[model samples]
Target chain A: MDKVVKVAVDAMGGDYAPAQTVKGALEALEERKDIKIILVGQEKAINAELNGIGYDKDRLAIVHAEDVITNDEAPVMAIRRKKNSSIVVAMNLVKSGEADAFVSAGSTGAVLVGGQLIVGRIKGIDRPPLAPLIPTGNGVSLLIDCGANVDARPSHLVQFAKMGSVYMENVLGIKNPRVAIVNIGAEEEKGNMLVKETFPLLKNCNDINFIGSIEAREIPGGGADVIVCEAFVGNVILKLYEGLGSTLIGKIKAGLMSTTKSKIGALLCKPALKETLKSFDASRYGGAPMLGLNGLVVKSHGNSSSNEIKNSIIQCITFTEQNINDKIRMHLEEE
Target chain B: MDKVVKVAVDAMGGDYAPAQTVKGALEALEERKDIKIILVGQEKAINAELNGIGYDKDRLAIVHAEDVITNDEAPVMAIRRKKNSSIVVAMNLVKSGEADAFVSAGSTGAVLVGGQLIVGRIKGIDRPPLAPLIPTGNGVSLLIDCGANVDARPSHLVQFAKMGSVYMENVLGIKNPRVAIVNIGAEEEKGNMLVKETFPLLKNCNDINFIGSIEAREIPGGGADVIVCEAFVGNVILKLYEGLGSTLIGKIKAGLMSTTKSKIGALLCKPALKETLKSFDASRYGGAPMLGLNGLVVKSHGNSSSNEIKNSIIQCITFTEQNINDKIRMHLEEE
Candidate 1:
């Protein structure tokens, strides 16, 4: 009865692509009635994978894309040259207003480049930051500029704070999300030049709820709702968070399985332990979004499975429903 | 029988000052015969704490100092004005050749600033870096520039890699230690301008073994012996490493104590679990040394315990014995 929110998905992206992407598309359609998917990839390969999945074709369509972008290819070159590539084609659909959002589980660089060069930025947006929701003990914290703009200025960080606050409030439904700049120390005088310069700017900004500086150690403790930094620092934090979490989980598993006594203990507490660890699993939260863009561009992991893919596709619906880009544009314009 | 390595310790530094510092000095004297300690602090407080502990009085001497640097004081101004501050007095002992090394469980900024201004840099050394040995599953990896100079240039990172390599080989006893730059991606070309520029410089250097770039996710796996980065990135890595380890350990303990069954199992596996977790403790490794200084200056944690302080004091012995600064001078001369 209502206009369908069309999402263009890169079917050829990710490690479990075509099959997982097709399956995810089917799942998204089955779960939501007010959404349509345009699977961009090789026609035959996508069709073969979609044949067995029992889903209504009315909600799904295949857009033929001839090429696939490899992970190692230069982002700018690939975006410029690979016009028919799955990632590029998906972004083109959003650019032409054929789709409301574009989702990819491909090369992070390509998605970021394509998102900017293809779909373009909202007016007054200085630099678009890739903001990801990282799992914390209490709930989730949004880390802006995970790996988009490495050499961001203080004004860029201020925009990140505003946009990150908007994302948390509208899509994730957190009211007055506390925003903080990632820094070496909590003091105003601490951190590098970027942080020192941005601290006062963030404090001065009346648009968002700025909570001041936060050290990396307090991030897992759920101290701030939105943690902002330049891409370089944010990327390091995100990678380290995932690395440390996975490594710790692996060590715990190895410790539990090492001896018979531990094995018995592990078996006894398997259910609860699994639940506890599951709370920290980032994959369940879906992909990071390249914020401040005209249309939604979500970048799922390269090794994303069908479940992660399904969740990422479903995540786009919330962004569309909440009009996140519109809100970002409004916020940017007000400044 | 050999000449004792005299260490000048800031007895008035840290959260648990005089008491913990005196306790550590006593413990170090009892454990090693090859070390003498000059405790710098208020004579009354030092003697009061020292009187409670029995140790070799001849090997332990207290040098009275009236001032103590607070954490909030400006580093440069504090170093300039606080002439007789505990940290400054201790460092002066090293500079005057009365002590081979200086150890401080004090404000990191004061220690760093004093190390540069008082102790001075080794000839040919461009910049001093803070190198901390972090515990890894394989053993320990040297994280250079944990919190020294921030917003570092490519040249500084090159010096870090060289200094870190020297420290790893000489102090840590790693042969031709593999040095790797901390980056977002493994590829040499895939980083910010700083990393990209430093990667080639490190590769061209013939003095130390240089491995390519390493992602932060692979840091815990012991992928590289020496992980080099600018202070900002290095500090983030070090803090996150400590945070994640403590958080995981806390989670494990809480989980084990949750129920009667788990509590009983925890008791059974207590010894093995403790042994496993002990390897990850950052305190066991002691302080981070401000490398490339003419005299050894170690910066212990602000909340360092007696054992950590003792361990740090003992660590300075190895640094002096191995002549790390002289070797750094030789390495820098070649450049």
Candidate 2:
């Protein structure tokens, strides 16, 4: 019998909650028999979506939660007040060791707050960063502290580089992953106060292979396997990356459909173009995992579809199995 | 006879110095007879590139500059010490009122420092920002303080909003241009300390059309005409925008060439695609202008070509003709 990697999923969160979340859970179960999902949300709503889906009843279970945390609500306040909310309940399951991981296609703030407050950070971990796997020209690179730690100090960024390295190496299977601090220029002396302070610290670190400064332009060319920065800079880069990718793709589509001659060209080129574009689709990689936590916490996009959720859940399996948190703790303790 | 706008050109600056700069000056004279260029660089090198170029010699003249500032040198120190360097000499023309503006495709740091230190800031201007006009979907938008004011305060961002508005409206002819402060999230409260502090101040001001917070994703889709942010965020977005644009274009070309059917499609679509792509080319928009200075100082890309140099020189004509600095001073004193 395969050992089950139990996942606690927030079913009442995200733009396409209950339906997409329930369907994604079912699909994940079908794809892998070595997993169990505890869906935490309104029982009636969840069962309505789950009805007639053929799967082992013992493997998939639903735990009823009375409330849903809306995106507009303050994350810390929501987590504190709404104890029975799906996100809070799901995180608690992971905290109690009832589940190995927690996945949510929900409010990023709520997930980040709940992950810290409920699931809790590992011992000696000062601050956990929300590290997302961004798609690059050659492959994916991990962008650490994308939205979590905005006012990060030099010490915090150093830890981000260390944690990000472990995740990229073990889970993503990049050997001796190249870690680079995000800066305005490639030169060590360039950048704002935070960057100038962090550069030498990162360069001097021996636990990871630290490349020098990486300007934002080099990011898409597969410049570094692990890109480290404070949350403010990281968030801007991540959002801009997504925005620019979609805008360009939209422009290309419009260009293809503009003329009759181009329409024929589009028809002939659709298959090849789709395959190439698929390679850059971020959802295929899964959700951003909040590192340095006692139990794994993953935050998916609010508008994620069934595939994204399934991929996110499956990603948790890899994270759990690889013992990423343990490695982070060990890496930190070596000082 | 049209009144000529005198622009001091840094002929020995940029990667294609002397050759492209001299050629571009001649081209600008050919395109616009109302502009006179004073080439500031080594006279021998400038004349060598200008030897065969046929133009009205009265509209083009060379003023010998003994040295050149390299990119690796510290900007402030270089500006003070290298008094006869091409960039410093060109800026001096603007400062002494011998030229209406100075244009350089040399080191960005040198250009920015020289613009402030030599040209000097307007009376009430706290800080002069390097505002670059970036290519967007429908048109171009001005990205203010891209690298100049990293530790910008709330007052600095407000001035950027005002200065950016004047540049977009008077220069780009954008009417009541929408101004937005770049933030991590679209919501009013979501962002780092700088954004949260600056948002409400912009909101209360009746001077410009202050659209609330804009996420980095909305920038490429022409979200706002005057996209305002502190230098660190602005720099990251600008570099990433250029990087991602090229990467996607490369991917699209690769996709079009993958198979025989797509190869024919590529041939059919090449003209239309090139025309569409040309609209988003950053060089066509000219160099970034250091706003709020006594005289205009435009910084073109280091890898600029003859066409970019021509466009940058021509852009100075508009800044001088429109009296942008006088308008900025007037706007500043009103408070």
Among the numbered candidates, top TM-score falls to: 2
Work out the TM-score per prediction: 0.96, 0.98
Model 1 chain A, poorest ten-residue lDDT window?
A267-276
Docking class of predicted structure 2: medium
- The candidate 1 chain B region of ten consecutive residues with least summed lDDT is B267-276
The per-model lDDT (C-alpha) reads: 0.87, 0.89
Error of 1 at A70 (Å): 1.5
Q: Could you give the C-alpha RMSD of every candidate to the true structure, in order shown?
A: 1.9, 1.4
User: Which residue pairs show collisions in model 2?
Assistant: none
TM-score of candidate 1 chain A against the true chain A: 0.96
Best by lDDT: 2
- DockQ for each numbered candidate: 0.53, 0.77
Model 2 lDDT tens row, A1-335: 65689998899888999899998898899888889999999999998997887888888989899999998999999999999999999998999999999999988999999988988888878889999999889989999989998878999999999999998889989999999998887777789998999999998899989988998989998899999999989988988888888887888888888888888888888888888888778889889999999889999888889999999999888888899998898888877
Residue A103, model 2: Cα distance from true site in angstroms: 0.7
Q: Ten residues in a row with the worst lDDT in model 2 chain B?
A: B271-280
Q: Going through the candidates in order, what is chain B's TM-score?
A: 0.98, 0.98
